[model samples]
Target chain A: MKKEWPLWEVFIRSQHGLAHKHVGSLHASDAEMAINHARDVYTRRNEGVSIWVVRSADVVASSPDEKAPLFEPANSKVYRHPTFFPMPEEIKHI
Target chain B: MSNDTVQYLLRLGDNALILSHRLSEWCGKGPALEEDMALANTALDLLGQARLWLSYAGELEDAGRDEDALAYRRNDRQFCNLLLVERPNGSYADTMVRQFFFDAWHHLALQGLCRSADERIAGIAAKAIKEVEYHLRRSSDLVVRLGDGTAQSQKMMQRAVDELWTYTGEMFESDGVDEQAVVAGIGFDPVALREPWLSYVREVLSEATLRIPPADAFMQKGGKQGRHTEALSYLLGEMQYLQRAYPGAQW
Candidate 1:
């Protein structure tokens, strides 16, 4: 019996007002241990204000191979470009 | 300014120094690779903290000495770390529980140190406390997991805690040295640090389904005065051997 627990993905916010970004994955018996392991592994520098650990199975990630089709189409949309519109000339400032 | 203050800080420094040295022994011997790295990293943090504290103590005494002099030159009768820390790393469970106990107390003590009257001490404490906080969390997390983990793990952790518990009381007891530091505002009231430490430990133990060992025993003492168990001499001999034998040899 392979009694080992599933792998978990770790994300951490380095400090306040920062988004939690994926750091790495670790194997643990449960969510608590996973977070603990993540802390020891990732936050040794005190580089986190918040952490989010999820079972690796639960995270939905976009495929890198699909990036051109998924994101490239938007690049040709001229209206989406902020340069299309001039900055409003405010009475007080540009 | 006071001789006793120098003594008190040296005690704190020695505890961190020796414990860090003991933890470093687990560098390649940990139960797992990740754990080995974690222990080794924590040991480095403690050694850094010890060097800073010892250097500051030396400065306060104006003894024309520095951190290395104190660390390498100190005799066996001069170290004041608890016997528990000096104990061999018997097992993963043993090391984790021992670290848990000390980290809990360290967190509280560092909190008090943050307000030290000495600017240097306060600055060091402020910086070091953050690292100790993480260490406390790491140790606490393992303690709970192991305590609630399996029958064998629980038994081992419980035994480690029981054996180490007697030494914990001395952490909160103030001696003449502590009294002087407290009066000078350069130290904390160890007794004042007790309640929060107990509550923190109690909370973790309770959640782990472990009972607090009865507090009725005759608490162990004398660690802060360089009077140690039989284990320390052996540990010191190994730890100080290179420096002692080579006398100022450097890499």
Candidate 2:
């Protein structure tokens, strides 16, 4: 049987001030190969200024069973929305 | 002088065109999806460079030909690309080895041309060097990985290096056209690219744990002079088919 390469999750920073956003996944033998694979697979259209890759196996995620216990309480917290805060018209970009 | 410059540009353009065709062969057939994309990207870059060069060649020739006419109408006997680029892409290892060798020379050649006395030549080289630099890096990285990889991979890479080494000599073989271009300050001497090419190849091979073939081994020549192996005829036949049948066909 042909052994398959490990899966890597890719992230891209589209510009200097932008945060790295999860893009996609690919298979590679190592981190360097992962980075190269990410560049080829995800950034072909001038979509990124920087790239980061992590082994998919290393990522942890909350299970669907934990969704209600972890997030249901926050749904009713209207104060978290900050809807009452007034915005200054002078602050354009914000 | 203009004729010599035109010929020099054809040499440059044909190298890119033929190699671009060779690499595009791997477009849907790469060992992996990522590799497929990478090879295709490199092929596109070379094709763009070819258009620039062949377009300039046609302009300098002052003939009715355009870039498409020059590219699709030329016979194999008229092509002046180095013999190395036309060699068959046998295996993945073979393709990578061929790519590594060509990319190294291309990077050096473009670097030299960046200082060309002709503004147009220098401009083309400047735009091309960035893509060629990335090509060199990727191919070099693969060479090391495959060469120092598993026993089977190491053996395959070694075989590829040995097989392709002889063809590399044609890249540095200077001739009358090159001489005229150099004298006219429109092109650099191919002979000057040899030392740096060898040093870089040697360093990379050593790191890859692959043996460097002896520098003085009997070398093949004549591709730049338009005497090519049978491989080029087959390549040109396929590459020119659409134009040959349709005659000025366009999308």
Candidate 3:
């Protein structure tokens, strides 16, 4: 009888200071194997320099039911848009 | 280019072409989905490198053959890849061992070719070096993983090492073709790559908890001279079948 390894979620950081974005998942016997598999599966096209693999079971997620009532208030906030700000003539670098 | 120089370049192309076709044999058959993708992706890289090499060889030949013509039209005796690349892919262990050995040599050879006095070979080598580096890394990682993994895996790996050790010798063998290319500044002497290749491979084997094959192991040769085991003919039969049947058919 064949047994399968656990699944892992792969996150890739393309460069420094950037968040590791979720790429996809794969199976491996351990953390090291997971990272190796992730490198081969995700980074083949110059995709990333850094990888983060976490057991899919360890990840926490909000329920899709929380989509509206728990977060809908921000949708009405027009002030969140950067267009409302006028550029100051002296604030060149910003 | 001298005919020997052209022959040297064609050998490099043939190595990639034959190895790519061998790797594609694992399609839909890898132990895991991720591995399937990895092997296929590797095959794709080899095929792309082969196109560049054979196309350049065709230009050097100046005999009106294009990449397709050179790849599809060539018969077995004309091929000059190392015996290691054209050997059959046995088990998964066999495939990985073959891959690791070839990738190690490929990476080292490309590192030298990047500095070739001939800019065109240097350019192609430099471009392909990155892909080869990743290939080496992936195969080395697997070699370590399986070598250090379960007892059954170690046994399989040990067997693979023993089976493929004989084929490793041919990669370092050079002849008049290589001599001409080296003098013409279009190729590197693969013999010089031997020490570094041994060091790197031994280090990987050490970490993998695998034993190196005994030095007295029987070594096979002659692929560089266009002689191969019967396996290459079978491989080329499948690879060249469509091209031979259709001749000029294209979608």
Candidate 4:
């Protein structure tokens, strides 16, 4: 039987002071190989100065079956919205 | 401006150009998608370096030739690249092994050239060394992994090393051009690169669990002086086809 390499999620930080954003995924035999693959796959066009790779299996996600219980009830709470608060002109930056 | 300097630059340029073309052959045929992109990137880097060296060679020759003219117009016999780079890419192991040997020598050569007496040569070397350093790193890392890999990979890598070992000697074969370059302080003696190249290669092969070939083994030569294996002609046939078919054709 043929074995496939593990899938790794790739993240790229385009420049300094910016967060690493998810770019794509690739298959690699190890973490080192994963980083190299990420560089070749996601950052070929001078897209990033830094790269991060994590195993796809390691990422945790909320289940679609639990969507309502996960937080749908919050949709009915209109007060949770911040639209009622007005921003002052003095706080321009915000 | 000297004839010998032009010859020296052509040797450097041809080596990069030929190897870059060989790597480009792997573009859509790499063992993996990531490997394909990496090989293409490496090829592009070498092609860029080839343009720098060839353009300088053309300018020094003052023959009205530019980088494109030199690249597309030259026949195989006019090319002065090492024979190792002209050999066919047999397999993934063969390609990586050839790359590993060449990158090791290339890194050392460029480092010496960075301090060349000629400011232009030094400047080109300074820019090229960064890309070559990364190339050496990637090739060396792959060599280690593949060499120390499963039994099948180990066998294939070892076979590649032995087969390609004979071709490596041409890289350090000093000739009249080399002697003149050394005397003029424009380039270092090719012989001076051998020791450092060997030491680094030895260390890497050791870490990779591969045996080093005999240093004084029967070696091949003549590629530096326009002689090459049959492989180069076929390579040139395809590479120079369009240019030969339609002179001065451009996109």
**What are the candidates' C-alpha RMSDs?**
4.3, 1.6, 3.5, 1.7
Query: What's the lDDT for residue A15 in model 3?
Result: 90
Q: Candidate 3 lDDT, tens digit per residue, A1-94?
A: 5699899999999998899999999998889889878988899889898999999999999999999987899999878878778897888876
Instruction: Provide TM-scores for the models.
Output: 0.84, 0.97, 0.89, 0.95
Once fitted onto the true fold, the runs of candidate 2 whose alpha carbons sit more than 4 angstroms away are A86-94
Q: Can you write out model 4's per-residue Cα lDDT over B161-244, one digit (the tens) per residue? A: 999999999888898999998888888788988999899999999998999999999999888899999999999898889999
lDDT of 3: 0.91
DockQ of each: 0.35, 0.76, 0.62, 0.71
**Model 4 per-residue lDDT tens digits across residues A1-94:** 4578889999999999999999889999899889877877788789999998999999999999999998899989999887788888788765
Q: Is candidate 3 or candidate 4 better by DockQ?
A: 4
lDDT of 3 by residue, B192-231 (tens): 9888999999999999999998655689999999898889
Candidate 2 lDDT over residue span B121-217, tens digit each = 9999999999999899899999999999999999999999999999999889999999998888878888999999999999999999999999999
Q: What lDDT is reached at residue A70 by model 2? A: 98
Task: Record all residue pairs in model 3 with backbone atoms less than 3 Å apart, i.e. clashing.
Answer: none
Interface CA RMSD of each prediction in angstroms: 1.7, 0.7, 1.4, 0.9
Model 3 chain B weakest lDDT span, ten residues long: B1-10
Q: Candidate 2's interface RMSD, please?
A: 0.7
Residue range with the least summed lDDT across 10 consecutive positions in model 3 chain A: A85-94
**Highest-DockQ candidate:** 2
Q: Arrange candidates by DockQ, highest first: which order?
A: 2, 4, 3, 1
Q: Put down candidate 1 lDDT per residue, A1-94, tens digits, no spaces.
A: 5766688899999988888998988877788778777877898888898889999998788999999999999988988766665665774542
lDDT per residue (tens digit) for residues B79-129 in model 1? 877666777788888898889989998888888888999888889889999
DockQ of 4: 0.71
